[model samples]
Target: MPRFSSDGVDIAYFDEGAGDPVLLIHGFASTKEINWVNPSWTKTLLGAGYRVIGFDHRGHGASQKLYDPELYHTRLMAEDACNLLAHLGLPRADVIGYSMGARVGAQMALLFPQAVRSLVMGGLGIHLVDGVGLPQTVADALEAPSLDDVPDAMGRTFRAFADANKADLKALAACIRGSRQVLSREEVGRIFQPVLVAIGTRDSVSGAAAPLVELLPDGTQLDIPNREHNPAVGDKVFKEGALAFLKARP
Candidate 1:
């Protein structure tokens, strides 16, 4: 329940355990509790002898909500993360980002490289370069009067998740629209840090991992078997691969 100001926006976060710090950024419409704590990611990393830092993005979780779509850019969110590191006086930390967070983490490594020692991008892949994330229809779904009004399959699913999360639909609607900035191949190619891209084999959202891996100077891919995007979060194989990657990262 701790908080910090990222350019005046209140960002809620939790810091626990002790060792190399690992910053955990959640996916769109997911809070830190929903994305990291409830999934036992905090437990997994803490058990692995690492300090865990998990934060709610600006429009999600216990953080302040802004209705302006312009306010939710990943660059600004990425700065929120770097500001958290600065708040704790840590020069750098290993980062693990899921879905939307992976995009933010990539921006972090690109714009604030000094704050990221290494990075693990989960539930996102080649789409990082090829796609802008989620879709405009997702924002439309959020703005829909009710879930039944949403027609897109993925949009309906996201609407349900957002409702279940008790999120501010207005704020999240803007987020889904504003945060879809895609990183170009050249932009991604510039992320010169040890990296791991883990995506579910069945995940239609993340595209493919190997193609994205090909762009990184030091990147590896992990295909989570028999899983899709959401299910892949707490997958045992995904955790094992991530831990292995984190341990071996310099």
Candidate 2:
């Protein structure tokens, strides 16, 4: 693992393999390893002859931890990604992001359009406009003394995932709070890059892929059979569809 300063915060990251770059952004309550490496995403991309770059967002993994909700805005996280690319001397790259990572990736496509060649919005769909999927209580769950104290089902799930990752609770709480901004249809439509919206058939959190796909000027959809938000991240269908999209995209 390597570390770099993004603006002022130190971010932990890994740059592996070789070929055209593919930035992998993990989900909320997830790290690069859990979201990408452990799921064989890095392996899959690398095997396809693509370079892989991944990092722990400021409040997650081994990156600098911040407690300010204001600092965790998705745009800021998107900036962090841009900075990572600038740091690596990459003007642009393909992006594959899941859940919160998907939102961050979309922001990158919007704010740094020239820096994103194409995008795969996995585990996210119409929710990009509707709002980030988790209930606000998931943030409250991060504040609970123990997982047992989180009575909300979704809250407990996130809390347990954070605890398992040995995450900084206060930093993640702020991230959940600050990263809730939504992109309007107008905003999403402004994204000019080719986009792939991949969601699970069983994903209630991501809304449907069609509506969001319809919003992108050049968007397509891939539905993972019998999958939910979390499980869909590692699905074979997702990997194949993503690889195929990458191959077909200009």
Candidate 3:
């Protein structure tokens, strides 16, 4: 229920436990409680003797919502995160991000490298900006409300996407069309911190994790066989791997 004002917007966040801080950023359409709390991430990290801080991104969860397309840019999202860390009075903290949150985390590390101690990026890839492997028509259909009216698999998919009220889906679709700027391999190489990139082996949208593994300066990759994007994070295999990678860091 704790909240703070960042970039003139009221942001909702959860702060729990005590130790070196570990910030958790959830993906698009996922609230802090839905993504990290329900998944036991907060408990797991807390039990490991780390303080966990999670917040609802602007336009998502309990944070301020903006219908304007320009407000949803990755840069703005990153700034919101920076403000949160500053509000907490912490100069640096470990960052763990998933999916859309992963993109924001990467941008934060690039823009404020000193504020980040280590990075754990999951459910994402270097080419996240490249249309996310969805067909152009399917992507377009996500914005067209008439498309949302249809019934069937396509309708379900569109509804799922439109449900992420964090910055209008229409605006997000437009951003994708205009910039196509997800993350890039070059940017991955530029990350100088110790890094861990975890992926579900069966993840279709993010593609293979090998490409990301090869790009990091100091990186380790963990693949959860037979797991999909959402399930991979909770898998014992992933938890063990992630904890090991994070603890290995100084």
Pairs of residues at least 3 apart in sequence or in different chains that clash in candidate 1: none
Per-residue CA lDDT of model 3 for 1-250, tens digit only, reads: 8888887888999888899999888876567887788888888889899999999987677877665646767777778888888999998889998877887788888878988899888887654534343344544655667644645564356447556533356544543443224656677678898878888888866666667768878878888888887677677776677778779998
Q: Which residue pairs collide, candidate 3? A: 59-166, 129-182
Task: Residues 1-250, candidate 2: write the lDDT tens digits.
Answer: 7999999999999999999999988888789989999989999999999999999988998899999999999999999999999999999999999999999999999989999999999988888999765778999999999998989999988898888878899989999989998899999999999999999999988888999999999999898999988899899999999999999999
User: Model 1: per-residue lDDT, tens digit, 1-250?
Assistant: 7998989999899999999999999999998998888888899999999999999999898999999989999899999999999999999999999999999999999999999999999998988888889888989999999999999998899999999878999999999888988888998889999999999999999889999999998999998999989999989898899999998987
Model 2 per-residue lDDT at 101: 94
**Clash counts for the predictions, in order:** 0, 0, 2
Better of 2 and 3 by lDDT: 2
lDDT of the structure predicted as candidate 3: 0.74
**lDDT of model 2 at residue 93?**
95
Taking all chains together, the TM-score of candidate 1 against the true structure is 0.98
